[model samples]
Target chain A: MSSNLILLVSLLAGLLLGFFTKPAANRARLANRLLMATILVLIFMMGARLGLMPDLGERILAYGRAAIVITISALIFSIIAVRILVWLFMRKRGGEL
Target chain B: MMLLAIISCLLLGLGAAYIGLMPPEVAVFVNEAPFYCLCAMLFIVGYGMGQDKNTLRGLFKENAFVFLVPVGTIIGTLVGGLLAGLILPLGIRESMAVAGGFGWYTYSAVYLAEMHSADLGAIAFLSNVSREMLAIILIPAVVRFFGAYPAVSICGATSMDVTLPLLAHYAGSKIGAAAFLHGAVLSFVTPLLLPLLIGF
Candidate 1:
């Protein structure tokens, strides 16, 4: 099977399990523990990759610029969009103030 | 399920990165950053679901007007992005920046950088990721302090995922559902608009 197919199957299986599990027990906690373990392993692998970088300074600069522009734009857009949305919808709903 | 999803994504990302199908850096990002993020997100989502399953049902029934909120958010986001492009001193790459702002920040930045030789891939990544993060943090505040509409607007493309829960939590599930719908509708629209506005 293709990796995509395998991934999809896994996802479906997980969803089914999550769906069937009663919310009362510590099932969620168990799932969280599993997720945490996965994350730690992934993080270690990522750090290894980062350590392979030859020029950390240049990479940081490049990534930094990208990060700054994206961050600012995202922040500005989010704030403004939320505000405008509230203004238009709230009034229509006859919301006070 | 969420854990499995994260693992699957990690594996896919790792394979893609290792195979040189995508930038190694991106693979690293997928591995390092999203693991913690997704873990926290999954736990929170599960906890929230456990705590408020009943409240969610009740809220949906109570506030039908909440449906209008997400519509406002989408419109607001589009306008905000356009305005940012116009006002910001982003130079020739402003369109790319706008595309990033529209929420395909990683793809937008990387594509534009490669095409234009602008080397702004990091900026694109940060811009888009920041939008997602900001939406996560601000959606609830925006909903409670301003209103649901504004909160959704601020979320941009993240309304479907990161901001959806917060919207449901604060604005009511009806509004959250509306936000998801609005986000879905906007996702397709964003791809088309990103290219037009950013020239990529």
Candidate 2:
């Protein structure tokens, strides 16, 4: 009954169903819209919960700093690694592909 | 547009709660809604993955270089997390857990909230969301300057869905399959990686 367990179960179920059904374009579109709505609701709920916390301002400031730092580092490192890989692997192919 | 909507929704919820508009009865629903909503979102994500037979099949047969994009992303993001740990106040494991989300913010945040503290979960959420925002801004520039691989890899798990169109537009349609496969691979790894990092 854990959240992760719930997530895994739901994902597996959907994967199996979609794999078998191979839903048509219309149904797939509907699912995408539904997914967007669900994500928005989840984000809203997350925000509301955080908003209800006592030290919201201070926590956001502290967490926001970490968020920005981690994001930049992740981007920098990813670009470096991928750049090296591309040069090693794709340079022979030539052109900006 | 999607990012705009996401931020707007978050702000609206924050504003709603800040203004004391949430009554006691509604607060009960707000407390529990994320669980169900997250389940739904993951289900849809899985379904999309299942539907994309080409991306999965291509993973096995495509030029091995395409696979390297996600590999680079995983390596770089975790290393960045480790480095951030050294400087920031957070421990290595916690910093890695936050980075390990790999841009799948909803699942990581919710999982950490349940397993650790809500504060850590919030940090994960903000960090991953910020990564997505950064990806949106950087994708075009990265494609123009760095190359398609970095541009696609920079998107983390969002390359397939949220940023696919942009990737296609900027990086060109030739790179679309590689980009989708890159995102799909990262998305698959995130759920497995986060729990191990947090639980350890």
Tell me the DockQ of each model, to 2 decimals.
Answer: 0.20, 0.66
| Per-residue lDDT of B158 in model 1 | 62
Models, CA RMSD each: 9.1, 2.2
Candidate 1 per-residue C-alpha lDDT over B12-119 given as tens digits, one digit per residue, 9 for 90 to 100: 543554445666666446444532343343344334334434444554665554445444544444554455556555553453344434554433443343334333
Model 2: how far is B95 from its true place, Å? 1.7
What tens-digit string does per-residue lDDT give for candidate 2 at A15-95? 888888865899899999998888788778777777778878898999999887887888899888888887787778873
Model 2: runs farther than 4 Å from truth?
A1-3, A94-97
| lDDT of residue B122 for candidate 2 | 88
- The model with the greatest TM-score is 2
**Candidate 2 whole-model C-alpha lDDT, 0 to 1:** 0.82
How large is the i-RMS for each model, in angstroms? 8.4, 1.9
lDDT at A31, model 2: 92
User: How does model 1 score by TM-score?
Assistant: 0.51
Candidate that scores best on lDDT: 2
lDDT of 1: 0.50
